[model samples]
Each structure stands twice: as structure tokens, then as C-alpha cells.
Target: MTDNLGRGASWQAQSSQSWLTVTASGVAGGPMQIQADPSALATNTIHYATVSVKSSDSGVSAAQPVVVALWKGTESVREVATTAAVASRYTRLLADPVRPYAYAHSNSGMVADPVRPHVQLYSNSGTIDVYNIYTGALVKSMSAPGSTLGKMLASPDGAYLYAHDLAGRQLKVFDLREGQVVATWPLDASLSVFEGGLIDLIYARPNGVGVLVVSTGQVFRASDGKLLATKIAQMPNTDRLVHGLQPFRGLSSSYLAASLDGMRVFSTDSRLYMVPNTPFYWDMDYTETNEGTLSVTKAYAANLGTTLDAGLSQAGGIAMSRDGSRVLMLSAVAGISLWSPADLSKDRMLAQDLGLQSDTLNVTPDGNIVVAGSTFGQGSPQFHVLSPDGRLLKTQVTRIAASTVKPGSTGTISALTADMAVSADGNVAIQSAIHDVDTNFGYLLTFAPIRP
Candidate 1:
């Protein structure tokens, strides 16, 4: 079941199964390679990726070679060999019940080999894997001290990239071109520090502000690598709120979207504050919780600030559009909340708001949306696209979230299963899951074009 994609062509992900082989025209799928489903195919009028998988293209059957198959439209393309996919003994001792960690790009782009479009991998294994966007082959692996790397971000110029080592007690910056360590900022700058659990993510401002938000609740300027705010991290996610923004185990990405493009952060606590480098420029204000209330405090936002646990309840799983105008949050109410730096007051709910079960969210390059909504207790989700007018694009039905029959669901719609992504053009989408395991664990679902 290999497929191919066109230039900037978007695909509407029909279903998410497991262990199936899929591909794009000339582009090949590989580990760390970006993908889009058949139904939501988006391309820039280029080559596609050819896919190669196991059987019936059904559910994923255990761990196999290569993560996905890349294709353009129809012809067989390439394969991201899973040969390098190693089995770790660490699971024997400290394994997570479900998916423990995942990756996120500060910007929206293809997940191909490092050669074609330049793909970067942020791992918990104390290193960043730079690969070929077309082949998923490792171009260079950047090493960090004795620490598992957290979220990562790259500069607009693609010159430098940064990550945090929770155990190494250091923030590492590597030269993307040189593929070597450029600078290491340790906690206290005197000695390395190790914190078992730390929350962190990177944001590259369109203006090149490149900022990194750490779990210790600190924000650092990714460009010059300057420490901006140390106290802003505490304002969001109060000690209270049972099952608030926190999720199962160490699995969720901190729900803070850096404002390097702006000047504030909407913390897990849900309060939007003015994060000025000066700090003392203005006093921070508090806000109300639950979904329908925002308390204003300054001349800027009358009642505008980020919401508490309502949007992204999961510890991790946070991302923003290329322009930073909208925030795609995951968990609970589980939908994308569209907000702008200009309007601090009202927040608009786009796509999957009307009776659609949502588990995660992602913004596409073309302003469309890719949402994963499943039924098998967040298992088999459908990928959907909502046009810029806030209306459902293409055919009649709703976006992909509820587009298909959810896994483990006999009824209309049950829950969302996995995550979603779009191409640089936002015309194509890739959706699938792991299936055929002890508990139907791995499944693959991709959305490609049926016709022009």
C-alpha cells in the first residue's frame, strides 16, 4: 500500500490503521521523516515518496523496520529503513505503559531525510538526530552531556539548534552546519544539574527570535541564547486543579507556547503574562479558570490571557502555526484555539468544535488544520482539513477527526487515537497508528488524493 504525493498537494486522512506500508511519488519515508495522509496531500509541485510496508496495510504488528513509507501519488517511491530501529533493554526496567515521549517541530515542514528539506530529531537519548528528509537516514547525530534531550528548535537561518538535558543540568546548542557542540549553559553555570523531570520546548520567531521554554518555568532567547524570564514559569498551572494540565507519567509536552514572536507565554497554569526582559516593566495579572472566563488586568488585554487546563491538559503536546497567530493545543476539550496577538479578548474555536471528539491538534502551512479524533479511547482518529474561512473544505462531511469509524468504537464516534501533521503547503496530511499487537497496539492510517 505505497502512495505518492504532488507539490503542495494536501491529503485528507481517511483512517488510521497499523503496520501498513505507504509512500509518496518520489520521496521516500524514513525514521524522523515528515508525512501527510492521502486525503490531505499537500505538495510544492515536486517528487513524491514511495512506500513499502508488511501486509493488508492494516494495524501495526509490533515494532518493525522503518517507521513509515513515503510516496508521491501512485508509483512506488522510497523506504525509511527501520533497520536502525533498535530494541532497547531499558524497557525491561523503566518502560512507559503507553507512548512515553514524542517530537514536535517549532515550525511546520516535511519530515523527510535531512538531505531534501532538512529534518531534525530531538531524542531523550541525550542527542539530536539530523537526518535526510527524503531517506530518513541519519546525516549527523548531535550529542549532549549525560542527559536525555527535551524539546528542540532551529534558527531561521538553520545555523544553530538547541535542547535541554534534564539529567545533564545543561542547555546545549549545536551548530547545525558543523554538527558539533558550540556552547553549553549549565544550571548555576558552576556545575551540571540533573532534574529527573523537566518540561521544555523551542520556538523560532519568524523574526529570528528563537526562544526556548524550559520546564523549570524559564524562557531563554534562542537567538542570542539569553535568559529572559525565570519567574514566568510559575504563573501558569497552579498547585491546585485536580488532573489539570498534567497527564499520564512524563508523557506530555509542556503546554507553554513561547512568545519570542511576541513578548509573553500562556503557561500550563493558563494565565497569559507580559514577559518583558526588563521584568519590572509591568506587574503580571491573574485570570479566571474553567473555559468561559478571562480576567483582564492591563491596558493591553481587558480580559485576555491564556486559558487554564481546558485546552491542553496533557503535560506535553503543544505546537503553533508557522506564523504564531494560532495555537494548536492537545488534551481534554482537545481542540485548536485560534487567538491573535492583536485580539487579547475573544478566542475562536476552529474545526471539530461541533460534537467532534478531539485528542490532539496541528496547524498546516497553508492555514488548513489536521486534527486526530478517534474512538478506541483515543485510538483510531480521522484527519480533517478546515479551510481558512472557518468552513469545512472539499466534500460534505466534517473534518477528518470524525471522518472515519473510530477503532474500538461501534457507535458513530468514540475518541481520537494518534497525532497529525501537514506539508509545507498544507495540501496533504498523514495519519495512521500502531496495530496487531498484544492489545492492537500499532496501526497506520494515511490520507491521500483519490482524484484531482
Candidate 2:
């Protein structure tokens, strides 16, 4: 990097390949160098590395690939070098979600710690797996004597994990760093008396400060699992905004989306609730009126009859933006729809033609961009980046071993498993994918948006 314009210029370099390392990370107004070592090759082969550069002034970044050829003690009879068009579509697999058990293993559990880079994944075998997203490595797994694990929640500071043991009727909090169970609280004995059994424990959530057990209607301090409140409906009244936590019965929502603070919540059931950040609570249930009509009612708010089309179903997912300004509804088979929280009016529809069929739609913490995974249909566009105004900005694909698609195929011949997470800045993303029959395993991928 150089400062030819006489103004201060700073540059940072990152290496995409393991064999390559940035000798000089942050070089300002001078020469920056990267080192590569590939002398231990047993056979002649070519290795590639991509070096990304970015200045401190702008979010835009650039990358260039460095190719090197290595050979064994014997001279190579043939040498082949390939050059592929390189955009900022840099995606790399971190690792398999669960390496030990890959056969018929689906990621049934996942939660990101609010304050740390730690991500907890639940496995089918009654184990809670934890991984550090920043390091791209599996830290550890926590399991108990029971096989029926309900829902898991992380503390705000990423120091603890609260998990519900439905079989044992207990809530356990683990210290993430030590990988040890710190506290355990027995569930309400009356819970087992419910007609639906103990499965209702699945609606548990851990606010940064305390854990809210929806099934049992109890709140526990996140630090020690101490009983904070017996019932969520009976919390001490305060003036601050209380985080609204409501578990709708009989609504089989496959996915649940909530604010980072764990306050506001919405599901595919078409119901949205906002809880006061303090101890107050408010919940609204969206009910089906007719074959194609829906209506919402509030117990406290009189004269409030809200209705909408019964288009929302299990095939789609709903999300409330971080800013609480917009609500996004998504279906991989369908397209995208945005609505206003104030009046439930349609705001903007990204249209199914754009291939917005992602497992979920996530808005950046700043609420600037809406990111979602894309499949083969609709021009085979990859993950899409949408501006606040709902304009397409960038389209990127995971860098994985993909099978060749027919000239015109309707299905997703090569598509991601629809699992992804975007950074708070909306500049980078980490996604999972399973590509090609040769490698029928899932891989974690990280990439940045290709600036136009």
C-alpha cells in the first residue's frame, strides 16, 4: 500500500488459503508482503491463495489470487495452470457441524450467543454442541443423562448456556468457557400434569439477564439459574420496556425469530407480540377467520380488529427487523414480502422471480441490508444482499464442490442447505452447504458481499 496522494492511507491484508499467511497484516503507506510455503508436496500439483485488501476509509475491498506450482523430487512431465474469474465471492467451509455422526444427521439445534462469537448446535443424540464462529472451530459439546433436549438459550455475555431437559423436567445452565454445568433448577411439578405432556418446554428462551421458560412459565437468572420469577405473567411491574415472550399453543411453527434482546417474537403462525423490556407483557394471536382470511385479536386492546389474507403457512417463515420498522415474511418456494408493524400493511415485495427462497431472512443489526440464501432457480442466483429500500445489491454463491446443472433445469441441481448467518455489519456471512454426491456432507462456509 502507498500514499501517493499525500493523504494518510492504511491497508489490511487477509489470506484465504491455509498455506498462505499475511506476514505484514496492517501496512500503512508502505509495502505489504505475504508469505507462502508449499515445498512438502509429494506430487506435482498447483495450489491457490486469495489475498484480500481493504482500506480503512471504505467498506469496499479487493482480492487477488496467487498461484504456485510445486513438484516432487522428480521433475513434472506436464504442468497445467488454471485461471478462473475471481470476484469477491469468497466462501470457505469451516467444518462439518457434527463430524462424528454424519449419516442421517440433521442440524436440529442452533443458537448464537448474543455477546460472543460462540454458536451452540443441538444434535439428535441429546448433545449440545458449541462452536466459535470467529475461529471456525468446534469448542466442545455438553450433554446430560437424558436424550430429550428441548430448547437452548445463550446468555447475553456468551458466558453461559441454558438448556431445557424435557425428559428430566429441569433447566440446566452451563458455563460456556469451562464446558461444565453450573446450575440446575427443577421444572414446576405441575408442568407434567398438563395434557400436552412436557413437550411444551420447547418454547424456552434466555434473555441476556435471565432465562424465560415458556412451558413452565418461570424465569431464572442467567448467571446462576436462580429462580427469578415463578410465572412470566406475574413479574414485578416496572416502567421499562419489557421483553414480550409468548408461546402460542397448537401453532406448529417450524422456526422462531426474535429480536437480539429476545423481546419481540414472531413465527410462521402469523402472530406477532411485543413485550415491554421491563416486566410488562402484551401478546396478539393471528387467527384464521375463513378459508382464505385471518384476523388478530388482543385481550386488552379493545376495538382492535386486525385482519389479513391467510397466505401465511408452514411453508414460509416470518421475521421482525432489528429496528422494529419492518416485518419480513419469506418462503423458499415463494418469494419475499415486507409488512409494516404499525398497520400490518404490505410494504414491499421482492418477488419470487428474484429467487429469495432462503431458509430464513436476516436483517443486519443496523437494519441496512436483508440477506438470504438463493438457489438454482431464478437465474441460479446465489445469496442476495438487499438494500434498506429493498433493491438488490449483490449476489454471491458458496464456494463448494457443485454438480453440473443442465442447460435449463427447474430444480436446484446445486443449492445450499439453506443455513446461514450474517455479521452485524452486514458485510460478511457464514453459511452451511452440501454439494455434489462425492461429498454428501455439510460444510460451513464464510464469504463477503461482492461490491458492485
Candidate 3:
């Protein structure tokens, strides 16, 4: 309670329900405590109450009613199912935004159809096999002639699937509704020849897709094969000297992320680069040995003070919140730190020295929760759920049984890799854990309704 008449006013607080208690009632306005007792309440039942506050000053017109809601439910996550064993390693896990299904990608070029939630596509040589995600039943198979597609990405609207045709040296855009290749564009022939190809893809505004090439960036029109922007990577003079410009000659991007609005793209090599999506805005020009002089920029290069851990790079060490307000970066030396997207400045250290070496990081669609997973070391692999403001919410360990452990030298239950994906509604999550020794065999775990 506060006095509007600039006079120190006395206030009285009362709770509407017996289960809700208000401490320090009938006192001068400053602060008070409200507590809820849930011991007598039934599980999974929501209870509501109101805290009424009245000011002694007559100038304050009406009493204020503060509503409070409480619910009692399970706080820990439970394992749902384990996937069937395979010989190829699972490289990534993705949760469908529009459906109740999850996709597990493998190193052997397997991806899930974003438009069709239940479809899983796998590539073998030039043949593509489509299967059901839940039942492992083969639905249909198709052929791509001479093209071997890899590094697949789905458009934001789930209308097209963009993939790199490694054998053809081109980018193939497959229309999901038409079920055919709609368009194809030639990539940098030099990079394809040297096995240095596109690293990642991010959605750009105005119906464009930003492609992160080796040490360079480009944007293309998703509808056709028109190139909108090119040669988009450049670093500051100080950053070039600190990281040694020689390594950048052949540096490959370790990770790439974009804000939700698709106006900015973030890429990492030895440091971070925040590239603007505005076309034809060249800030600097630099000459390379074979590529000639190219236009670039140093407008938003950020030095994070520490070189990121290489081991965690493949496990996705960087992520942007859905609202594009927060950027989370995890380094083995610094743990996880939150950064503001507006200025690329450090907001706060979210977590550090968490015992387990975290390898993967993700944020919920609502940007309220942060999830991090660790690689197995001396103990079972674990994942943590946290708030954006740096509060730990839940911690879960895989706890694989010995019977499920593959036969090995030690016969210990451990995972070599673990990755997580949260649903669009922020209520569910799926985790994939690869076996320590087997490498190919792994387990899939699910957490539903993370909060009640």
C-alpha cells in the first residue's frame, strides 16, 4: 500500500482464505509477506485467493485486491521412452512447433519433415527413405538422382525444405506441399571443391534465408534463386589482431543463430559476429589471396573475452531467446552467460561451475525457461532447467540402468552426448542421449508439462 497524498499512511492487510496468510498486517506501508500453505490441498488442484489492502488515508479511494494462485504438482521429470538401436550416431534433436512429435537427426544425413510432423527422412547414397517418427514404419521412399542432400533446414512457415546437395554443388529447395524440388541454386563452387561448404542456415526477413558459408555469409530469396547479399563477414581490427587473421583465412563457422524477427544473424568462429540484414551496406573492404577484395563490415563484432570450448561447439553452445531479447552463450571456462541482443553487452552471468561440463543450451519458445545438458563424464548425464534471470528451477539425471548398458570394457552406464529440444508451448521437452562406448545406440527421454 502506498499513500497518494504524500503522507505516510497506515495500511491493513487481510487474506480471503485460511490457507493464504499475510504477515505484518495493520502497519505503516512499506513491505509485507504473503505465504501459501499447500500441505492440506489436493495435488494438481489450483486454489485462488485475494489479499485485500486498505489505506488509512481517505484520499486513497478504494482497497486494493491482489490475486494469488497456487497449485501443487510433481516437480521432477520422468523418462518416457528409449529409441531403437542404430549404427549411426544421433547428431541433433528437434521438437516440432505445430505437432506433438520430436525428430532425431543422425550424422548419416537424416532429417524430419517440418511440414509433416510425423515424417522422418533419411538419405542413403542418392535414395531418400521416409518413415514414421513414432512407429519406425517406412512410409515411402524417393530418389534424388545425382544429388546427395545434407545439412537440411526448414523454412519458418514450413513450406520448403532447404538442403545442401553435396554431390551436385547446389542448394536444393524442396516444396513440401508439392512434394518435389521447386528450385535449385549453385553454391560457391570453390568451397564445394575444397569440402568447405555452407555451415548453417537462418531465416532472414522479407522472405530470405541467410546462409553461413565458410568464413563468409550470404542471403538468398526463398522463393527463387536470387542472391540478396554476399560477403557478409568481417571483424574489427583489434579482433583480427587478437585472434590472428591467418586462421580466419580458412576458418569455418562453429555455430550460427538468428533473432526471432530475422533482422540480425549471429555467427561464431573464434569470436562472435552480429551481422545486419540490411542489403548493400558495406562498412569495410578486405583483400584475400585467391578470392580478391570483397566488401564486408565490422559494425557489430563482439569479443566475449574467452575462446569458446571446441568440444561443445558441435553440441550447440549458443542460442537466442524466442523474443530476441536475450542471447545465451556457454563456454567451458565461463559456463553460461546471458547477453543483451540490443548492444551485445554482458547482461549477467546466468550460471557457472555447474559441476558437469555443459555441452548444449536451449531456450523455451516463451523465453521464460533455459535448458542446458551435459556430456557424460564420471557420472550419469544431467540436464538443468533455469529461469532467464538466473534461477535454477529443476535438475534431472538420466540414471540409465546397468541392464540397458551396451557391453563394453567397463560395463558402466554413461552417455557420450546429450541434446535437448523444447516444444513450442514450453510445456514439454525431449532429450537424446548417445551411448558412451557404442556411440551409435542411445536413449530418448521426454518431459511433459514441465510446469503445472
lDDT agreement with native, every candidate: 0.36, 0.42, 0.49
Provide the global lDDT of candidate 1 against the true structure. Answer: 0.36
lDDT of 3 by residue, 16-124 (tens): 9999999646544477788889898876444666778876666554454565555355443333333344444444444433333344444223344433332333343
Better-scoring candidate (lDDT), 2 or 3: 3
Q: lDDT ranking from best to worst?
A: 3, 2, 1
Error of 3 at 279 (Å): 20
Could you give the candidate ranking by TM-score, starting with the highest?
A: 3, 2, 1
Residue pairs in collision within model 2: 241-276, 241-277, 241-278, 242-275, 242-276, 242-277, 242-278, 243-276, 244-275, 332-357
Off by over 4 Å in 1: 1-84, 88-118, 122-124, 187-198, 204-210, 213-217, 233-254, 258-331, 353-360, 376-382, 392-452
Every model's TM-score: 0.50, 0.51, 0.58
RMSD to the true structure for each prediction, in A, is: 16.6, 15.3, 13.9
Where does model 2 exceed 4 Å of error?
1-107, 132-135, 148-152, 164-172, 184-311, 342-348, 355-359, 369-374, 377-381, 401-415, 439-452
Worst 10 residues of 1 by lDDT: 89-98
lDDT, residue 330, candidate 3: 64
* Candidate 3 structure, TM-score to reference: 0.58
- Candidate 2 CA-lDDT value: 0.42
